[model samples]
Target chain A: MAALDVAPAARRGRPGYDQNSMLEVIVEVFVDRGYDASSLDTIAKRLGLSKSAVYHHFTSKAEMLEIALERVLGELERVFDDAEALDLPAVERIRRIISEAVLVACARQQYLVLLLRLHGNSDVELNAMARRRELTARLSRIFEAARAEGGARDDIDPALAARLTFGLVNSLVEWYRPDGPDEPAALADTVLAFVRSGMLAADGRGPR
Target chain B: MAALDVAPAARRGRPGYDQNSMLEVIVEVFVDRGYDASSLDTIAKRLGLSKSAVYHHFTSKAEMLEIALERVLGELERVFDDAEALDLPAVERIRRIISEAVLVACARQQYLVLLLRLHGNSDVELNAMARRRELTARLSRIFEAARAEGGARDDIDPALAARLTFGLVNSLVEWYRPDGPDEPAALADTVLAFVRSGMLAADGRGPR
Candidate 1:
């Protein structure tokens, strides 16, 4: 991977840069430079710290990856768990899950980007992919249940719907700038609006 | 990057593996191993050809990448160009662009995947990204026109809608299998159905 275009001022690691901050930088580097190309040495150099200082927090690059993946995956799984536990209708539960997921994805955009980019090169990546698949499967089941309950359209496949829904949600990481105009809540609202009613006017006079 | 798990039988180059076939293999390796990690040596080995044979078709790895990116980007640009020439309403034109884009994406899944994965690491990648942004901008303008025509809902931002629409469409690269059950036409239909009307039933009695 090409070296990151880091400014010299940004290279100076802030005093008391804790493990969480270090992991954030690590995830950012991993995303910018492909994980395979990124190393602890490069990461330390970016942070303006010695390799030993970086190693004080994490044992290996894979461990850092695991921690990052866990942070995002764990949050998503919790959203799923909480949504599934709700007494609301299946469709309502689906909405809750998607809305919460958009928020989680926005909040943990870098980690989510790394998680999405993984091609299962290592045990950590493979495990993360498995968890992601499980999450999708769980969402598919909810869609199936919603269809059976007549809350969702029956024509579309549940698995396809689940994938496409999350696909749109996940795409936010590619262009969503937290510093940009759209707040996370508003972004989630727009996403929910699109996923719920789509872009057509209520009159339904648009293209077939 | 870890070596691709090529079967022994598949390692041998097929008879008459011309430039088109060679480009296909080159793209496959590039996507699997990543563009930066991939090189002429690795690609030649994967194709069971000598480095000179690989060199006969392309000058360097960058040329191969440029050719692969052009295949997808060129097709998408054609789609946009054709859609713009249509004498239909803005909303209908938007539908045409998206449906054609989905078809292009499915047909050239690998090339499209590489295009989306690019982060401007090189001039070739930056050029492709610029063309992609232009395509998205065109789609966003169509959304704006559609909203003005009262065919699409005006509540959401036009640019955001365009991105989310294509986001769902582009997500096909992650999990779509050509040998899978859903045909490209059927997949496009489902996507169009979702984009036109969302997952909710026509009764609109589902989640808020």
Candidate 2:
């Protein structure tokens, strides 16, 4: 599970800037300028507020990152239990997860970009990296189970299959824009269709 | 076609340090510290040379990036024509292209990492981004042909299929160390098998 499964800290926001808006601005700055280049001063100046105003909500830039990533963590960490993912067949489970993943990416694109852009440069980032590894390990087990049950391709290593599946799911963060012409549901459907093409059993068709 | 299709300028290297070795060093640094954090001074210090010495072969960090990306561009641009990729069945063509992509990733790990890490901050990066789009467009065409000929799935849009496939292929930069125990061929095979499953026709067979 993602480390930030619970609600993140720093929910307090000033009058005009609610916690969500502040979080968006913080992540946007981190995205536009590399995480290493963004600073408290930059955030404050962009917000037309004093450093104390920014500090009133979050103690450090690292905290801002944590807040930003928490959104994506919540969305991504719930992939297996999300509404569309509930009660799927083993083969269908793979498709449901990918489809749900695309929707999450579209909804939380900046958070995904920010998380991937980090370089594990600090304690917070190192922890974030470890959390990501944990999520991937959990995913690896699902692929293992699907293959073991004859619901998925057995030729490749489970770990590799997991990475390939997540790669297709996660790469959407790079190009999928919420306001873009493509709708999230259809995107999920298409992505699942393509990835499912590769994950089917050798004899053809889903486990059913 | 890739912008770096032609021989990259400035391959001259000092005695004891061939052009290939220098290129490796430059790309490794770019991969390790990222293009933004890697300064000329840092490269000089890492290479045990003066700033001017680092400058002797390349004028700026941008030039170093260009030179480094060229290696990967060359490998990828040739995937369609590489011995293993040529004269394959429509469905097998997809397999071969994915295989070639994995090998290219293994051989040019640093260069691939550097290319993916770019942020389009400078003209060099903007061009790199454009080149990547062009290559993806070419891959899109291949997917279109395959789907049209009933070699691949036709339900999803060809462009999205190409992106999903390449996303699986290109995300190798985040992992897949060359020194790792997994052989490139096996990795390619596993990836292709997974992808091919969902691409088969309703009756459950490839183009063959």
**Per-residue lDDT over A1-208 for candidate 2, one digit per residue giving the tens place of the 0 to 100 score:** 2332222534455456766677777787887776766778998987778899999888888888887877787677787656335565555666666676777777777788887766776777777778777777777777777776776666667787777777878888777777778898888877766655552223344422
Q: Residue A208 deviation, candidate 2, in Å?
A: 15
Docking class of 2: acceptable
Clashes of each: 0, 7
Question: In candidate 1, what are the lDDT values of residues A114-136, reduced to their tens digit?
Answer: 89888666889899999999999
lDDT score, candidate 2: 0.71
Which numbered prediction scores highest in DockQ against the true structure? 1
What DockQ was computed for model 1?
A: 0.42
Candidate 1 lDDT over residue span B15-131, tens digit each: 667778899989999878677767778998898888998888888888888999999999999998999998899989988888898899889999998998886767888899999
| Model 2 chain A weakest 10-residue run by lDDT | A199-208
lDDT of 2 by residue, B148-180 (tens): 677666676777777777888888778788788
